[model samples]
Target: MQGVPEEWTEEDGGTGERSRGTGTGKGEETMMMELTRLVQKTVKESSWWERRGIDCSILAAAFISLPPAFLLLGSSHFLWFSAGVLLMGVAHGIITIKGTHLASHGALSESQAWAKFWAVFFIEICGSFSALAGVKGHIKMHHAHTNVIGLGDSSVWKVPFLSRSIYLFIAPLAVPVITPLVALGRKYFPVERDNRTVAMVTLGLYSQYWLLINVSGFTSPLSALLCMLVCRAMFSVPYIHVNIFQHIGLPMFSPTRRPKRIYQMTHGVLNLPRNPLLDWMFGHSLINCHVEHHLFPFLSDNMCLKVKPVVSKYLTEKQLPYQEDGYLSRLQLFFNRYQELMVFAPPITELVGVQ
Candidate 1:
């Protein structure tokens, strides 16, 4: 509370905390500036490993896990093959999910050139998605507009025509197949075509196919293809769920009447408690420390974890909302409310004072 803006402090006529829906312009600016300073100071004091080295280790381990997985997949034993497939799927998930996420946000490096390099490597070569589209949609649109109804409220993930069970359970399994096709179709692109994006995506798809047949020792190309699809979609259910559960049912705002960044993010974003598998697959930034990630997009996953206590405590002391929910709880909420939350768009929450 030491950094709480004087205008909104208990001494002033105003309440110690701004309501979730509104903040005075000056108070909002002052509050964010103070919080920004605190975050910066905390980040600056942290070591290099906390900021970047741990992610490097995580990426390296995921890569290391692949060779054994391939060996197991090639085995004559059914149990060994099954174990191998599971291992391979988990490794692939970690690399693509955690790698693409960190690289997309430039959390791996300070240099724009290195950032773009990693973005292409992880997103295009590993994830088989266009790096340009990923950055444009995620950083520019999603992060910038957050819970603004038409822009960043995870609307794109919804399919009104599909029943809840189909959408949640069956549909996501095709994500591995659909992701590149959607990118190629220019569904999310701003231009008519991007040759580099198309080429890299094609290369990634072929690389996976080649690996499945060759290293995984599948004699039949058709069998290899099936193996590829199954491994790739191992975590698709949670992947789809995480995308929506974090933002969709939260407080949504009208695009034209957005609140300050702090209020918008705190009210709109909800963090799921950590699970060991999810933590490894999606990085801490995407999981338990989502609010911190949205607030400090550049922070590495380790850095985000380090700052979680600071962020949660600061918000609490200021009487600002700090949204956190259980993973199972959110899953149940979505399951029960699918029709209301996904099939039809929810109304926007009108802030008390803005515009």
Candidate 2:
């Protein structure tokens, strides 16, 4: 943990995701409130098409994975298969980072079991993570303590002197490789049920990978393993980078800190509206509609994009934060704030008020 601070409280309970009327930004007054309302209005009025777009992306991600799987079945060309797997793997990474991550937070829907299963399928089955263990660490630990050292996933494998700009690019490539080791290492050393799942899932994934490649006659057993490892390594780079963009470089608060939910979210996290074509392909899960996703996880990526403005308006009327930095601006911030941004910090422990 980086460091715990004081705490905040409103009439309802303590610091939480919801607003209870009383808050610290009471001083920013009217203008901020108007912005919040505007944002919310925009979110509310979002069109059906936008929502559909998100869904398309999700399906597209899955679609992209199929060809490579098919390729391994027929061809033994390691390079060709590696390239295809690398692409689809990236798709899985996007869905996991975006869809599964939100779903795990119960942000998707109330169907706890469905969310749980989706989380496992996306992260463990595809993106290479243990669903339960990832949640325990992500929802319970990381989200609970955004940038607190040793808590947040963002901070987990950061290395000093690694440039923030490059780090974002590098992390995706690292995740498929590093995250698994971390999961397996923890299980190997101390042992945890989720960790055991890690063992099981890893075995399953590799077995499937090997069986597919070999049965496909794409390569000899030796060659298939080599190709799989290479694809995973190449794929990890961008997957990690995309994950980093979703949340990092925003104002972090201790448990005591009372930043408006809107501000905390907008500034706290990022929205990279990049690769419109790819966004059409995998952008939904790559940080697009992020604010809406956080606000309403289950609202298909399509729904979130449409309602983003409406939500923004409501948040605006409430005089909350509504940040949407340009892609370049965010990239710069990551470069400037990588270390602190990646590390997790503990919540503040202060007065309990209607913050």
Candidate 3:
């Protein structure tokens, strides 16, 4: 209720009639339309062929590369085996984060049925997270209401008991292990028409386990499990880190004083410098093109990158805040202000006089 928009409220007149024009509704509309045009121009430049190719290639790499890496475990060469496992883990992370993210937004396919199929396959099956839940929680809640406390604040990862070092550095390692358990645990809560999805995801995870232990001819079950965990850890750490860094330290607002679309996105989203490691796995949208991604959530990673200059320049010319900070700086900020920013709720500043 605190985060509800002011425009939705009506002032009670003497006759008990409601007034609807209290907020900067017209100004917000204008800003939204201007940003929408920029997004449309970017969309016109995007090619479906390129998007499909990138999606297919990433999916293929995730599925195709891992089997050979698992086979390498039988070699018993420590260095070679470790290298293979690392590669497998990075690839799996890409599938889980990038692939699942795209599918969750329905960006991977033109057809609704095909999009649903892919979202279920990549998110629930490969990523070991529920697709339906992700769309409702992530796309609908997080994206729609970024930096709004109790909605898009991303406080789920906050562990008050753990010190900054442990919470930031060590706890993330458990994300790969924790994710599937959380997914299964969600079944106890009410979700509509989700029984089949839960079953499929459970079966899919079991199928992967069976592949490693029985079919892949790993030295032992332990080896198979180790391989899976290693790969998932490669993804889980940065996945948690990026999620926090992108929006946590920036401006937050109550629903009544929430900024217009462009202002909210630019003010709230902070882009990290491009890192080769993260860029390749998480894709551009998760990396330096984050502001662009927040502006156009449906855009492919490549498209997000392509439109960066235009969006950044427009915001800069307009004298709006377009935040960019180095990855290390953000980590340090979080470390220094962990209590203020992470453990407790971030303070909300009511945006005033923005048209």
Rank list by TM-score: 1, 3, 2
User: What TM-score fits each model?
Assistant: 0.91, 0.67, 0.88
Candidate 1 wrongly placed segments (more than 4 Å): 1-24, 187-193, 353-355
**Model 2 spans > 4 angstroms off:** 1-57, 60-69, 72-87, 94-99, 106-110, 145-153, 161-172, 187-192, 218-222, 233-235, 260-263, 277-286, 316-319, 336-355
Query: How many Å off is the CA of 350 in candidate 1?
Result: 1.7
Ranking by lDDT: 1, 3, 2
Model 3 poorest 10 in a row by lDDT: 12-21
Best by lDDT: 1
Residue range 90-208, candidate 3, lDDT tens digits: 77888888888877766677666677778888888887887777777776667777787777777777788899989898999998788888787776344654675678678877776
Tens digits of per-residue lDDT for model 1, 1-355: 2211222123221111342234467767677777777887888898988879998899999999988998899999999999999998999999899999988777777766677788888899889888877876786668777888887788889889999999999999999999988778775454533777888888887887788788877899899889989999999999999999899888899877878777888888889999898988899989999998888776889999998988898889877889989988998998999999998889788656532
RMSD of each: 6.9, 7.3, 6.6
The stretch of ten residues in a row with the least summed lDDT in candidate 2 is 1-10
